[model samples]
Target: MLPALSTLAAPAPALSTANTGFVLICSALVMLMTPALAFFYGGMVRVKSTLNMLMMSFISIGIVTVLWVLYGFSIAFGTDFGSVVGWSGEYVGLSGIGLTELWDGYTIPVYVFAVFQLMFAVITPALISGALADRVKFTAWALFVALWATVVYFPVAHWVWGAGGWLFEMGVIDFAGGTAVHVNAGAAALGVIWVIGRRIGFGKDPMRPHSLPLVMLGAGLLWFGWFGFNAGSWLGNDDGVGAVMFVNTQVATAAAMLAWLAYEKIRHGAFTTLGAASGAVAGLVAITPAGGSCSPLGALAIGAIAGVLCAMAVGLKYRFGYDDSLDVVGVHLVGGVAGSLLVGFFATGGVQSEARGLFYGGGLEQLGKQAIGVFSVLAYSLVVSALLALVLDRTMGMRVDEEVEISGIDQDEHAETAYDFSGAGGGAGSRRAVPAPDGLPATPGGPASAGRPAPDSTGTDNATGTAPHPKVDA
Candidate 1:
């Protein structure tokens, strides 16, 4: 019966070749953002923890893709069961859906649209990984991703994008996913970090990024891929809205980068590469929801505001004492809120739909709707994510031991190292000196020394019983 139905379910309107091609390309671009995120995050952690950082982002690609195909899509976009969520099992395993079936209004095949959304689901939880870096166990982290996606992400996606979603029906404007993706992930990140506590050297140690170049590379990739992210939300190529989104994306990102650099110069007296990269990301997050509704100038304002605000927000971790390792809460959550709300003030009715904002004389109705969307998602994500982390912490242990953390998670947890310095030509590979016990003089060949050679039959040094110079070369 399902097979027969599938055969007869061909879309009524012929597929728009241009729209299908555009969506397919956009899906590919969005897929690249996850690996780009890995590099961005990998470079921000210490050398010993770099591989784990990359793994956190890369693992999401595998985990979420499978879930989306199995049941996640159904829960997010299936027949709407209520305002809170879509019906479960409606599209399980994509069962009974034909290859040629088109989504309600989209011109692309249903699977192509599903794949586009799959990229979003993959990256949303990965954003949380940045907050819980270094200390989380791989197994526990994997379990968290699976559970959090089902409990937090899918339902939220439904609330914002599903056919009968409350937020959607309330007339909220989310061009992409400021509420459902960034704010949701950011709130969840804060929740988990609160439960996990701080890193071992949160306040004392000089914990710094190992590679800024890698971070810059990741930022560039994110900027590039986001064009597809924002413009592709249109899901068709017939309209000029896609071009407007693309241009607004570029201008907003550039403006935000400048704004962040200016803020850093005033606050710290120097513009840093990391700040530039972070600012670009802040801009991207800010413009996401507002791109379709806002003009280019509005995008600039949104980006600049987000850049400055996120720059300041990152410092909140230090003041409040939460160990958000990579500032996910600062940039995503804060930036998401800024974008989602600013649209209510900046939206114009010329290029896209005719819903005007307050600045355009639409009053405060849209702003109120935006606030509802933002806070609702934030509240839900925070409570549920914190609960998930606590449960995992109790049952499977969410964090690594102190010894493993101090020794470097890459080596202790993965049994591998990110960098090897064995042949760096330190002291010409000579045996280092070792000091004697108590007040005794230091010797060249002793058990305690880092590079000491084996001693002769006598416990003392083979060449000289007398103590050599006490100095030990590095």
Candidate 2:
């Protein structure tokens, strides 16, 4: 058995070099997921909004990391308060947590654990960015992240994983973050979008993803990083549970990808790259909570189900008339709910926890518990997120001007473009703007027009008909 933590000024306890090293590596891997998410969401937006999409996810790393170091970590993992929330001020600035202090029952230092969980805190809010893509203000988004992380994420994290958390006490089986991460973010996405309303051209425009290759690349990164996210939650390398979770993750993802393709082939008559990427993510989200609790076959069932369901769910935004720009609500929220609840029927006592599902003769008890956890988080996140968005919308405004949106958010918000049509990269002096065969205006933020000396500060070339930055009218 491990020894109790030593008192202040005492020599640090001997560390488990293996577990410590493993968690550190896993922490680094998890950190990579936020940027991976940026790419995943970035590739889905139009060229004009591409960088803004990337920024929405990238900024979470900055905002949440600072908050985590201050009180985010403390509220999540600090002393518990009635199991409803942790004391946010107790570990203010991580004051009492020492560098050498070992986390209970783990070989890693408390600081390492804090940082690892911090990665989760960072990405949870970022997940909502995709649903609001193309229309929201960057400043408003940054502020929302700060507020949501403090108000929603930190407290929820405590309920799920913090010592003495209510859900932990109630025996809810969230191996990773089926509830805290995916469901919470998914519900929150739905709420914010409701308050922000639909995108300007919703339904009328095609709004296809700008770059599928980037989407594929982002999906690949998410798959690679998810191994760390799921298995790393074990907090050590000593047990077989991490390996089980790792393999479960792989099998479930493959099954979901194939299942999604099959469903698409039947419904849409063709398999697309976007479908494959979305299916893979659906699988990843589904198995996150159930990975350690089920067998390989159980993982397959979970993945296939999520793939089929989420593909269908994505269309709900259009049919129901609510815009979830990037399907964050469809994939993460729906898939998360499926995974968490399904575990109640598939969980095996012999795998990770002693809990057995109905299929294994454990009956409906566990399933009831799972439902309570899922809906509670879903309802709470949905209500609170909408309130936050409404407050922001009323005060400083949450969306960009219509003119700026039409011209492209990247150029207007960031004062830069993702692509330059000027042929400047290939050594060609300049290019003239040419209208597309569609007879629409040249893409406002598209490649530069030829025969123009250069774009002026306003992002337009007067010599040619190219307008990189269209004028925004009040």
Candidate 3:
């Protein structure tokens, strides 16, 4: 009884207010990424499906936050079970933690850690929405998010980031979710799309982004928030590791953007705004895992390589007849793979861990470990996500009726349109007449005619303009 009483009196770990504040800010930034992603994906889709695209991402915030509090935090960061999953009765509903209790060795409160991780869980599933835009039933998608988070996301997170998990135990360095978040989400995207099939007019129609400005805005916000996403994974700035990661993140993103533009100019004969935005995202994805271990130079290489690779990969969907509506497979999955593997070749051996890449005399050992981590997560996520999607499709019906898809998913699913052009003309789809200058008559489908249809929303080459080919548009 005395020993028990003494143990009960043991002091809790101290918390750092500075680190706490930093993590809270970082959490906000990551939370913003979900909505930012919505805009990015929203603008890339047709005007009719825009609201649906936004809702698909926004709903994850609601769904995942609830789940994380209930059991997700535990299943991910709880006591490891067989190095596959995790559990803790205390973590159920987040009721057992004290306000002052710190997260294991970290200086921040466990609550802060939990919430930060919760943001990660929220955005991961949101990333898959872009792949299935314009066809899936909203109810089916919501249900899929809940199940996938439980069965796919929670377990994979444990395997990669949890203490005593197999991948973590095996010395695979993910640093900031190259494998856990991006690869996990990307592979899941592929799996679910395979089950659900393609959009009705995938190849034949002029599927272009409705608002390049919105895409740019979202891309800018993502860039802003990603600083917190990458640097905050270090959990604190007490060490210089977070600082190094910050620098690497910027360098890699710039390099990737340039590399993508260069590839576009060389291959397609035009550098496009879409390419710029997609290139930046590719860089961000590539640097997610490798940034902590790499120097600025190494990050530049990783970003550039990923940019070109992902740009090339986006065209494969057309060749193979898989309609990845928004290039989730090309950018996230391929970029995630590029970033995770490049860590093996580019790790500096000084930051994050003692492990070195082949260039630093670390031999092929680290690269091999990275490959194991990369493909294992990819395989698990791809297979399990497909099964979950299949189950949902068979039971609840994953897709909306063909009529709803052709008409537009926004009105069917959400009963709202992103843009109301009614004030401009007769109705949302009607074109307004532009007043002709002086005595000049407005030419049909001409620049002066408001009745002229807008250029293909994605900035693709169309009747009115010559832009980049739609095949490479994200």
Clashes of each: 0, 7, 3
Instruction: Identify the superior model by TM-score, candidate 2 or candidate 3.
Output: 3
Candidates sorted by lDDT, descending order?
A: 3, 2, 1
For model 3, where is the 10-residue window of minimal lDDT?
Answer: 457-466
Per-prediction CA RMSD (Å) = 10.4, 8.0, 5.3
Best by lDDT: 3
Write one digit per residue (lDDT tens) for candidate 3, span 1-474.
Answer: 356776777576478899999999999999999999999898888877889999999999999999999999999999999999999988999999998888998899899999999999999999999889889999999999999999999999999999989999999989888999999999999999899998886776777788889988999999999998999999987989999999999999999999988988888777788889999999999999999998999998999999899888888887887777888888999999999999899998999998999998899999999999999999999999999999999998999999999878887787666764434432334444444566565532323534445444333411111245545564
- What shift in Å separates residue 427 of candidate 3 from its native position after superposition? 12
Taking the tens digit of each residue's C-alpha lDDT, what string does model 2 give over 187-256?
Answer: 9999999999988867665566677798899999999999999999998867799999999999999999
Error of 3 at 473 (Å): 15
lDDT of 1 by residue, 322-431 (tens): 88888898899999999999988999977667888899898888899999999999999999999999999999999999998876787666666565433222232333
Q: How many clashing residue pairs, candidate 3?
A: 3
lDDT of each prediction vs. the true structure? 0.84, 0.85, 0.87
lDDT of 1: 0.84
